[model samples]
Target: MRRLAASLATAVLAAVGAVAVVGQPAAAHGAEVFPGSRQYLCWEDAQTATGQLDPANPACADALAESGPNAYYNWFGNLDSNGAGRTEGYIPDGTICSGGDRGPYDFSAFNAPRTDWPTTHLTAGATYEFQHNNWAEHPGRFDVYVTKEGFDPTEPLGWADLELVGSVTDPPDTGGPGGDNYYYWDVTLPADRTGRHVVFTHWVRSDSTENFYSCSDVVFDGGDGEVTGIGDDAGTAEPPAACPDEAPGAPGDVTAHDVRATQAHVMWGVSQSGCVTGYDVLDAATGDVLAATDGSPMVDLTGLDPGSTYEVTVRSRNDHTGAVSDPTAPASFTTTTTTTTADNAAAAGACTATRTGASACS
Candidate 1:
């Protein structure tokens, strides 16, 4: 029996609502941190000296404001420096900065909006994979930061909430003067970490100053036997269906033999199908449809003038879905020769005798 192939399908999930926080922040910390909380922070020096944080500013503020704290950033040109501090120390435009157009600084130049800080609902003990693909024209690399919500940018190492995992350089095949950059990090979710973790995909500029651009696409598979909703189903699309099953048909067994002087006998298996519409006999050499039958086997090749070889193949079609089966193996045969008697008339008319000559023909 022939096996048929089935179609392919995809499974999709639904989206969940934003998380809400209920408690107040401690006096030492500023605000209460909860799951799903999101915000932005910028280098203080860049904001003050470059006036980058003001929403009204055309270049710095506007560009920084549009980016989410969790978003990824891409620094322009080569601005290699060290450490994140005042903007002038990192940014090229900074007057106090010693590095050319770039300085070494920490979360000082630009940050996400304070109110719209991103909230992370990641659970501890679960593993997550962070992937980044940079198809940018120039060399681009980013750093991943998982910090606590509502952290101060001014304090040294204050933003180092939870280092789930980090990759500062571009992955292989993503670096160099050409080509895109790709990076990914796999980390086991912290058992102590829960509700509203701040996930940051920061672009590490040449200068120590870094900028945050986009948030990570969070996906929760399993952990602690607890099912916490995280991923969005509305955005997920189902995979397209697979190809339809092939139609069934009788195994094609065809045979051929020379007949008479210029004819040949061709025989093929009668097609049997639950949905067989028709069957076609094709000349294997020329691909021409020699004949079409509702569902019969066997055909005669006449008027061939003998001593000629021919090849034939057969195929069946499904009536319901219009699916056609592949052609069967070809069958080949040569026509037999014909002969007439001479005056001697002994056995001169025999096909073998005629070739032997008059004495044999006689």
Candidate 2:
């Protein structure tokens, strides 16, 4: 395979660890030839051609030698090479005429009476990908046309024509002109439609010639299904121990601090067993668990009387095992209140009257 070339800036960027590049064209267009031999033959009528062979003609033997079993190419001669002087340089006129060669290549063998046509079975609502494996005759980019079995091959597989799909270039390993290039297209079947579907792929060359081939590897898979949960309810068997656990662990390092407006802030470090499920905030004063969910780290308490103290704590929960972790140490904080001089004097007077034990004038 020829190495695809890259731009200097691209090379420099890759060297600097910025980006990775792939599939660059190594040489200019048409710079390289097909890797192997080009000449091949397909017989029109093997029985008639065989009987017509003249035993006296040595050229006929060479042509016959080149035409192997099933009338495929016996040798890869320089048929398409530009250096070959004959028009359509690769296949020679002498070989074509001497061995009963027709003006165009014969593909009758691809159809029945010669060989069985390839069959493709597709499922409903599934996307199918298709490609061609051989690249000898059809080089350069091409379009694949599909149609119903009863219609002419030239007719397109229109909207009502069952499911006509195109594929990306066949990968080089699969025998595309470019090494192992795969042409692909996504096709989906109607929900209610099922049964046998016939698919055909043909390459339209630069000369507007159509070279047809049949394949059976196109496949279909049903569309996306319902969403699935990932925990105990998910029905899948428990994974190995190495997998993260859902249970919560012991809590630690509880701390409480003051905030404005009779509110206090609570913080704690949650310990996890295997995996941290989530955390919970609790009202320490009433032993009431306030918030319960995963990923919340802090909570605020409000509406308390000024100069009053309050306690807060937090606990963690695990998602996988459905376990709740131990609570963190309790912490406390006091809220502050504002007072004027008049209010202080009134408070002092009330305290003095209460201390004197006098039932003075009401």
lDDT of each: 0.33, 0.31
lDDT of 2 by residue, 25-102 (tens): 110011111110011111111112111111122222333454422122211111121221221233232232111132
Off by more than 4 A, model 1: 1-110, 113-121, 136-143, 148-157, 160-181, 201-362
lDDT digits (tens) for residues 287-344 of candidate 1: 6666554432433343344456667787766545667777889987764565312111
Which regions in candidate 2 have their CA more than 4 angstroms from the true location?
Answer: 1-245, 319-321, 338-362
For model 2, the run of ten residues with the poorest summed lDDT: 23-32
Clashes of each: 52, 24
For candidate 2, what is the lDDT? 0.31
Q: How close to the true structure is residue 145 of candidate 2, measured as C-alpha lDDT?
A: 32
